[model samples]
Target: MSQPGPGSNHAPPAARTSPESGPPFSEAGGIPVDAATPVTTFSPVVLEVPGRPVDLRMKVSAPATGDNLPVILFSHGHGPSNFVSSLHGYGPVVDFWAAHGFVVIQPTHLDAMMLGLREADDPDAPAYARSRVEDMRHVLDHLDQVEAAVPGLAGRLDRSRIAAVGHSMGGHTVGVLAGQSTADPADGSDLDLSDDRVKAAVLLAAPGHGEDLAPAVAEHYPALKATAFHGMTTPALVVVGDKDWNAHFSQRRDWHCDAYSRSPGPKSLLTLFGAEHGLGGISSYDAKETTDENPERVAALRALVWAYLRSALYPGDRAWADATAALAAMATPVGAVESK
Candidate 1:
């Protein structure tokens, strides 16, 4: 089952739904919404991949009524595309930056790649890895076209200021885009360094950190390999929940301490104190259990993430002063114990 390429006939999803547009995750039960901005969404145009029929999902947003602005591309973790865009659809983050003044695009890669078609008949087969990267490339190209059509989007997108954000498998895509390898095992052989379009990356709860990918992943794509995040030239901010299954692994440790230390530009690691692997934003976490145990910890986790995103995206912007202050203002919850 081949997918529609970069300029196919698929229609983009309707924009401006709710504040929680990225992934559906609640910290302490109830419902979660963005505390930062008004949810004004923009429509996306469906395009086909050049040489293939894949349909890539992309939404563009600039300041509601401003000129050009920095562009950020958001890629969701691996799984169904719906899983990524359900509630906190990355749209909220895009909307946040747009509200503060920036153009953002979040692409639906996994959905377009796999389309729920199992290739090897094995439920766990790695059917969409190849298609995933291709879709990423296609999305970038599509965005270029989009910028061209909308004159206002042209110069506004600071090519050198572009950044990529990812979680789980999407983080691996960012690593690949950053020139980190996914083939040579000990070396970064599978890296796609040709683009040079991305300026920075934010990898959240990356599943691509282990020595070898998980068994299900390994079985699906035996050629899959990855190396240390050593050669990244641009600044980066790696965020991980301390309780992530691999939080204590050597790869995770090296990525933070060594990778950040050796990188040419500035870099930092932020470990969310009590958040689980999926963080507090995805559905997989047991929010009921967490809330029953501790509530302040949950709020702290969200605040830390929002602050990191603010400072990283806008660097020296004065408006982010509040976010920076919030970062420092964070304190340990009354009864929660901090862990390394």
Candidate 2:
């Protein structure tokens, strides 16, 4: 479909209740909540990239009414499940961001099980690590097209305030875009896919450098062996579960914090107590994969992420400070935030 032109008069979605009125602030850090702005979502917004076998499709969600909205390009994790790895996944995070006034764009990468593409079928599939970074760049290149797809969303985006967020394998994608380095599996050369446009990043349950990978992990995912976070200088918030231990990946449960530890300063880590890789079901709502299905945990995560993004993107915003203080003040906090 052709991109929508400027000056189009598109109707906005209806209004809804603000988040503050719907729930108590005790569970989530007592950050003052704003009146909920309604959200409008557009799906299957297709864009074709040169040399790609399949067309790129994404879902765009934004507040029903807002100006100068920031953009968040969310990359879904690689998984055997077809549904979670597509544009249809991560409603919990995407919806919350949209309702809170950020325009979130999610692209279904080649690795998605829905496409049925395999490395054996094509040597260079979208499922590969490098392609994931390219996919995010393509989304940024077509921001105008994305804005055009959503009614009344034209010229409302704050292109300068962009952020990249991802989960698990998807977190690796964010790390690469935020200046992490890796060696191309095809040719043992260094690969740098960082994009300066990404002002900030969020990596959730992301794997660390491949050097520490266990024998089983190294054999199954050889590409991760070349993954390095030394160049991930961008400001980022790394979230991990204290109990998220994987025998296949590493012997240490704290291995997931490598992104925050290995990366340079201006980074923050949030360790969720008794949480697992699912991180309180951020991937989907009530999915069987969620070992930690506490709604309060999800709520806390959502609030913390939103506050971190707001504070990072907007220098004057103290949402992060207030939220962190509230968390510290809690007699029994769900998690802790540490920055370096």
Candidate 3:
């Protein structure tokens, strides 16, 4: 059903200098660089979300040959780039995930600049904060239709094993899906938006509680003022860049670590050494908004995320552990990985 989106409810640490430590994949974590399978992507797989501002349109990317593929519900961030915040963006992340495994689904949220739907006085302006989550729920609810729209993509999906991955504002959406709740800024009502269908998640450069938000930011997105992590009990891997600081959001660089530091057990943290908000142009191949442009950093980040999702969806997989070791073995590690 329809609900609040981003700007709806709200929401790292580190260890690496560089990940040039070793080869791409060791015995433990990563996959072979050249081993990625071919992928097929279907766009504009439109679906109906009742009460939504517009019809839900998505881009589905999956392996050309695979069975029992796990699913990833990728949510884009509210970046400054016009198209990077929509389904067409995050090519670096989406292509990589779809190449290795997992069926990637990216939705064009109502606030996406690509949609050009926002207005000066629009109630959903500033980003549909709450409605973003609604979009994910709607996507999961209509997987049958989504599969049918994509040729040879049915039955290959493992509906029971689903994970959520989000960056920036999108990470806030994952937080809510993983059980984060907060008090409404307008009223004292509790906002519980977590979804049981999401078994694991990744929160990248996400914000902390609204109470500690920059005075200017909190004024507009008040629902995040007290977004608590005690309720984020889902298994997740939280990724944060050491140098990802934005004065418009918060003055504290460590504010991004709350998703890992404040949350319960079964959570891990990845700290990328010299990265910024874009995390090496994950939004686009050459995203203008990417302050730190390093292809190696992007490769490492994508590999680690893939490994995390692999082991998370499969109980006996060694992808996460192996990838962690491979990263740590780098002569110049990308960052550090730790779990509680």
Best by TM-score: 2
Worst 10 residues of 1 by lDDT: 4-13
Model 2 lDDT tens row, 1-340: 2111000111222344444545553334444545568899998899999987789999999999979999999998875456887899988878888888899999988888788774445434434677788999999998889888878899999999999999888998899999987767677588888999999999988887777877755655556777777789999999998877775677666678889999997999999887877787787876555666567777788788888999999999998898888778878888999999
Clashing pairs in 2: 18-36
Q: Point out the higher-scoring one by TM-score: 2 or 3.
A: 2
lDDT of 1 by residue, 106-132 (tens): 666543323454343432233344455
How does model 1 score by TM-score?
0.66
TM-score for all models, in order of appearance? 0.66, 0.89, 0.89
**Over 4 Å off, model 1:** 1-40, 80-88, 110-114, 118-127, 142-144, 148-156, 184-189, 208-216, 221-224, 246-265, 282-325, 333-340
Off by over 4 Å in 3: 1-34, 120-124, 182-188
lDDT of prediction 1: 0.48
